[model samples]
Target: MQQGSLARYKLYPSSLLWLDSLSQAGKDLRARCCQIQACDTDMVKGLAADAHRLLARGDASGGAIVLICLADRCRDAGELVLAREYCEEAVSHFSCYDDCRHAHNLAVTYYALGLVYQSLGLETDAIGSYDRALEAFDEARSQWMWAHECAKRMMNECDEVVRWIRELRQGLALGQPAPPLLTGTLVKIPMWSTSAGSLLRVREEPVDWVDVEVSALGLANFALLINGNSMVGLGVQNGDVVLVQETADWPADGQIVVVRMDRMESESVLKRFYRRQDHICLEPANERYPFLIVLPNWRLKEEVSRRYAQSHPERGLEFFLESSVHCVGWYCGKVG
Candidate 1:
């Protein structure tokens, strides 16, 4: 947490440890946590007792800090389940306190939870937690950065990257790009297709089709205005239109594809597809966004949903969540 240029000084001024740095404060807590780490079942009971005592004392802020530390201690000690429970409770307790007072600590608390989730193999949840931590840290930095800028009369952003972001990316494989694969085909001839066939399935379908050229693709291709910055790492900026070729085929490793996850009504996500041994991995180019792991059945989803909706006219529009990843097409290239 202390790796950043600004974080070294602004971590805990007067709130948790007064003038003491995190390392200085951890000495006593670490000693006791080391003792708690030895016992198997008793560790859980001991920490629970410690948390209860801390909370019951009416110092909610202090209790939250202690809980966060205890949660980290549990994480380091290989007690994954206990780490998750305690860190979550710490977040719950700390949430009542004003954001101005404990934003940085709350960010750390969320990071600790992300670590626990990563340990348990919940990759998506881990990334989601990290995203939350980043948001909290951003909030925490505003006041400190503002005060420092005011003192110096400088109008500039702090250039240092936060420690948690770097640490999580390295740990979660978010920083590493997948290895390249050889493909014989430089370009495949796409079958002549049009937008007329695909538009029938969507409820709020687009009426006017733009003639954004996708090299040679026609009837089988579609366009989407990129909505989020999740793919900024790929030079895909927000509001830029992307051309996609219509296909339901599973993409080769590291191939970018447009797929709708969770529901048919949901907006499609542009991601790098990697098929793992167990689950499918759909990763975004940006670290700020969380990647997905799913086993979707898009065809089954369409069948069941359309049947249910058509069978019951009085129900208006109600569909089951039968899929998690519905492949819209493979990404052709960015148009705008």
Candidate 2:
């Protein structure tokens, strides 16, 4: 298309071709989409040191779309605030076009905003935003079915959130924290030495509950119990203890890890990490599990290491004892 004709469509200003049908134009758009995906992948892998770069090449509308995409990426990457900001930007993008497209975008944006608000502890505002998003979706009729469907899902989520909010409110009114149902020692305790002697109890209290400080072990602040022998060589076996850390930071190279997959209640054994300048490689001790590399610098390795060292002086030996230390933390034998 001619330069003057291109402006007539008012499509993305940066995109030379406005139509999506042309093969070359499709290729260009796909390429731009790929660029957005690449940036999102980096954000997901926690290498998003400069988020602005993701929007630099795109036009205003393109930037808004990219930001929305990046918000999803950030959510997956565990960067909640950044994700929220991106969603907000997407909402701000269609201020002039307050038609169906605007309503659809606002619905999606507000849904995302609600999620971020809920995560950030703004429950009331989250619910309100979710309600507004639902209303926006209702108003965006006959515009975009996909966006409408997304709004429907968000509306359903509101029901769940409302239940949670009500439960929380009841707790607050009662001046008590919501009681955990399965209360007796929700954590796994590992024995000090694996010599088959009487297991040592790390906690001196009457042991009604086992509290493990997971973050102190160079892992995320969470723990999981391994129910299989898939991770045997790494001292994790069936019924063995596994600890997981969940933070925005990525794992270092060749460190043992626990990853909660797409559909599993228990987080499975991820592999030891292998660090690189650009990415961190996960290598499972058992060859059955394939190794994969993710963008590096997801986790604060040095900080985790220093914290782990301060917490467990004896366990620090593993760093020097093994060719590579993938995991650092105290593990105890799991008992009823």
Candidate 3:
């Protein structure tokens, strides 16, 4: 929180100092909290009582500050939900304070909220919190570039390197020379299979997929595209091109699969396939959608049935190319 607030109050050294002092004191609350269960569970109780008294004395800011301390204590003890509730209450109580009227503080509150959201794998909310934090930094005209810099850094670390590779392979398969990049144009690469006697190709205006250079060492190149809001818990989202390769046949449960669902249809959705006794089920990453179940006696093709007969299949699906799937890894760019 202090780090987040610092970006919004570069000019107000004295105010920053005071806030930092309070933040440090909040840390002290943690030490006292450890003593509470043994010596006095009443320590936090006493603090809350004192905070209420402060509130009655027209010191709402002080009271809120104390609440923040208690909330941090809860967070330290891994009681995140409780911590978040108390932090929110603290922010609400101090929001109207004259001395605490600052964008930096507001940003800190949002950042703290973002932490809560992130802990629960609420990617959409976490992104919003980061955005609000940046807004607060902008409002204060802060000189600190940490927030923006962090954004840039994340992009650098986790950009769609795989998508670029997939586009390149797709172009090669289509008997077309690769362009500079495949991102600008959105082309749906058709799923093809000789074994299934399926040949589906729905081509549109070609996209110039980006070219990402892989490391010189043993890391093989791969690519995939992200679609839908599923996999948000894993920080992978729709429209992100992912890069992956064929490993061993053994994949633990909950492994994602870029499967060819419909051999007859021109397109197929990437689904996470879970194998159960006498059943092959397709699960989506997003909980909003229902999982698809295929019973053993279900009327799926006989050829595919025997192909997936084993409890643990000898080989997971293999891709002809290295970059076979793509996903927008998290941060769907929606704010609500």
Candidate 4:
């Protein structure tokens, strides 16, 4: 099989040889054309000729298959205009039939058309073609399991693009000034234990939406409700909601940050960050809780001496592997 023919077969397995009228010679010609490494202008023209002959013989399915194969090849070769034309032709031929087999063919053909339109920067046209493909796939689903599965996957892929395009269009239509405030969710912090400075486990539950100043907090921000008074010396108190700016960059020394300790079950905590020569240190604002040290190799080691540990029952800290520690974001300020 030629590369183009193989690609078409992989994309539309159910419709590759659905036409009963396709001669062995015609199929052989398609395979031969597709196998050639370099498909020059003459070779492409020859494939087009074969497709035209199939259509002339009233073999719409066969012709559409050939056209779809050509479209795939042209698109791969960066011939968008030719690819679009071939896809449109294939769709037209597939539309002439009404059976389940032809419905599957139409589904694949419309999907190919969508790809062409998407590559050409015609997002609206691409979305329409994807919708048509989805509809055709729905019509064929009872009799064609492959079409149904393909349609489901294709719909998943197109959904995000369609949403982004619609949002862009809406923004352009509105032509309004950017909003002054951004909405951020305030999330509850789960406690690790009854210890005052213990690690806080962060969950995905949003407690409520808080309007934050766009100039101050930016768009990517969230609020965490303070659970303990470990950082009271830094002006943070229990019941205070700390605003945080989401970032992937390393936090500066002495900056407060939300740190996640990666374990089989990950846990998070807020602390002041410090980078030493050989390890990183997470220090609490109050002196009661010992500072947690993350070694150069990503292991968490505590600085508490045995004598101090014996005196302060709640002062002991566990060793966390360095790979398990990540800085989620820097603390902005207390949320009003």
Specify the highest-lDDT model's number. 4
lDDT (0 to 1) per candidate: 0.51, 0.41, 0.40, 0.59
Q: 1 or 2, which is superior by TM-score?
A: 1
Which wins on lDDT, candidate 2 or candidate 4?
4
Model 3 segments more than 4 A misplaced: 1-42, 97-101, 141-336
Evaluate model 3: give its TM-score. Answer: 0.31
RMSD of each: 23.4, 18.3, 21.8, 20.5
lDDT of 2 by residue, 53-141 (tens): 43354344444544554454455345678867776766675444655555555565666666566556666766677677657656654
Could you give candidate 1's per-residue lDDT for residues 1-336 as a string of tens digits?
112322322221111221122232232232233233132457656756765665786655655565665554455456678878878887887667554336666666776677678767787787888788777767766755655524222112111324535565566666342111011101222221111101112224543344432112211235566666777888777766665655555555676777764453454577777765545667677665554556444444455445535764333322223255577676656543
**Candidate 2's C-alpha lDDT?**
0.41
Give the lDDT of residue 283 in candidate 3: 57
Question: Which pairs clash in the backbone of model 4?
Answer: 2-34, 2-35, 262-324, 298-322, 299-322
Backbone clashes in model 1, listed as residue pairs = 193-219, 193-220, 194-219
Q: Rank by lDDT, highest first.
A: 4, 1, 2, 3
Model 4: per-residue lDDT, tens digit, 244-314?
64544445566677788777255577788877666676878887766776764532234433433676567
Candidate 3 residues 1-336, lDDT tens each? 222221222111111212332432332332232223211225656766666676677665556666554544444344567657756766576456433234445545554555455555555665665566555444433323244634443232112222332343344446555342111222222111111111222223223233332111001122344446655555556655543322222123444544432332433344555566555555555555444445444354454446544542543322211123222111111111
